[model samples]
Target chain A: DVKVTQSSRYLVKRTGEKVFLECVQDMDHENMFWYRQDPGLGLRLIYFSYDVKMKEKGDIPEGYSVSREKKERFSLILESASTNQTSMYLCASSFHSLNQPQHFGDGTRLSIL
Target chain B: AQSVTQPDIHITVSEGASLELRCNYSYGATPYLFWYVQSPGQGLQLLLKYFSGDTLVQGIKGFEAEFKRSQSSFNLRKPSVHWSDAAEYFCAVDQAGTALIFGKGTTLSVSS
Candidate 1:
């Protein structure tokens, strides 16, 4: 079975602090995605990377950025964290094929004070 | 624009009852549809996906979904509701094979 691992299941940070959320997938999938899951808004894509060192902005990418230094690792960075940035973060990976489904990590619950 | 919509925000059902969750999408061509379930405090799990062929797709944990092209809808159904089935369900559509456009999600609550 494919496994997607998030470094932290729960994280707490103060406003203006820079935060980094890490995710790693056992499968060598070519596509990686970062999303924030809010109560009513559902899951809003933050960023996605199709290849190492290549990233694309999703629907909501204002205060966030991503880095894919290695094939198995993808990182989400919060330049300046704020209270509004606190949310559940999810990481997913999938094969590059058009019909492939994405595998997701357990998710990281971030709290910004 | 391509989009996915899950009409119900929340639904409650008694154990052993039948279940159905509605999903609708607006796209030009035949769309790639998917159903995902997220347990409390967990990430989203792929329940099922419809790429082509069979309109009715069976998913994990005794769940299934059917794609209706004429209605532009893909609704999830289950023969019996289980307590474990209580979770948030999301309907998504693939946008040109790059990213998925997800619906707002419907929270299912099961009562014993």
Candidate 2:
């Protein structure tokens, strides 16, 4: 079975603090994604990387940035955490194709105080 | 740009009852459609996807969705509702590449 592992399941950070959310996939997928899910807003893509060291901005990528140093690992970075950024963050990975389905991590619920 | 819409924000049904969740899409051409489920504090799981072929597609956990080209809708259905099936369901459209546009999602509640 394919597994997408997230570093943290829950996290709390203070305002103005830098935060990192890590995701690792064991399926050797070439595509990794970061998304923030909010109530009523649904899941909005923040960033996605098709290959190592390659990244693309998604619909809502203002306060967020991503790093993909390795094909199996992707990280989401919050330069300065704020209360408004508190939400559920999800990481997903998929084969490098348009028709492939993305496999997701369990998710990390981040709260910025 | 392709978009998805899950009209029902919430739905409630008793155990063993039939279930249906409506989803609509807006795209210039025939786009890839998908349905996913997310339990509380969990990531979304792919329930089913419609790329081509038969309009009706069966998925995991006894869930199925039918794509209606005329209505531009892909509605999920289940013959019998289970308590464990209560979760948030999202409809999504893939224009190209791996990026997916998702709907707000519909929360399903199952009661005894």
Candidate 3:
């Protein structure tokens, strides 16, 4: 079983505060992703890293950034948190192969006040 | 223009009854389809995926999905429903190893 762990299950922060959400995978998968899950919108990719120091922007990359410094960890950062940015953040990891499925962490529910 | 659509927003089914969730996609070429479920307060879990060769693909937790090329549909079905199966189901489409385009999602409600 693949284990993907998020740093926090729930978070709260004031507007304009910088926020960081972390994820770590145990399977040593080469691909890591960060997404925001919103009602009626499903999951929209924010950023994804194929390898260490390599990152790509997804459809909704505005106002968000990601870092992958090591093989097992991926982090999503919010430069200036806002009320609209409050969402459920999810992290997923997959093997390098395209046909493989992504394993997900439990998710972190972020609230910006 | 690649997109996935799940027409149903919410579904209510009795325990032990058969279940089916509809998923439709629009793409220029061959598409990889997948079904995922998310429990309350949790992330999405892959239920099944359809790549090629086999139109009917089985997945974890006794879920199966069938891909129909003519309709560009990959529908998920289960022989029996359990209470624990109550969750949000999403249908997604992607190219080989690309970012997935997901549907709005369908929420399943189970009755005792």
| Top TM-score prediction, candidate number | 1
- Candidate 1 vs. true structure, TM-score: 0.98
Interface RMSD for each of the candidates: 0.7, 0.9, 1.2
RMSD vs true structure, all candidates? 0.7, 0.9, 1.1
- Model 2: which residue pairs collide? none
Give chain B TM-scores in order: 0.98, 0.97, 0.97
By descending TM-score, how would the candidates be arranged?
1, 2, 3
Q: Give the per-residue lDDT digits (tens) of candidate 1, residues A1-113.
A: 99999999999999999999999999999999999999999999999999999999999999999999999999999999999999999999998878888899999999999
Query: Which 10-residue span in candidate 3 chain A carries the lowest summed lDDT?
Result: A94-103
* Model 3 stretches astray by more than 4 angstroms: none
Kindly report the docking quality category of candidate 3: medium
Per-residue C-alpha lDDT of model 3 across residues A1-113, encoded as one tens digit per residue: 99999999999999999999999999989999998999988889999989999999998999998889999999999999999999999999988876777888999999999
Better of 2 and 3 by TM-score: 2
lDDT: worst 10-residue window of model 2 chain B: B92-101
Runs of candidate 1 with Cα error greater than 4 angstroms are: none
True interface contacts reproduced by each model, as a fraction? 0.74, 0.80, 0.67
- Report the alpha-carbon TM-score of model 2 versus the true structure: 0.98
Task: Give every collision pair in model 1.
Answer: none
C-alpha lDDT (0 to 100) for residue B35 of candidate 2: 92
**Candidate 2's residue-wise lDDT over B1-112, tens digit each?**
6788888999999999999999999999777888999998788899999999999999999999999999999999999999999999999998575788999999999999
For model 2, fnat equals 0.80
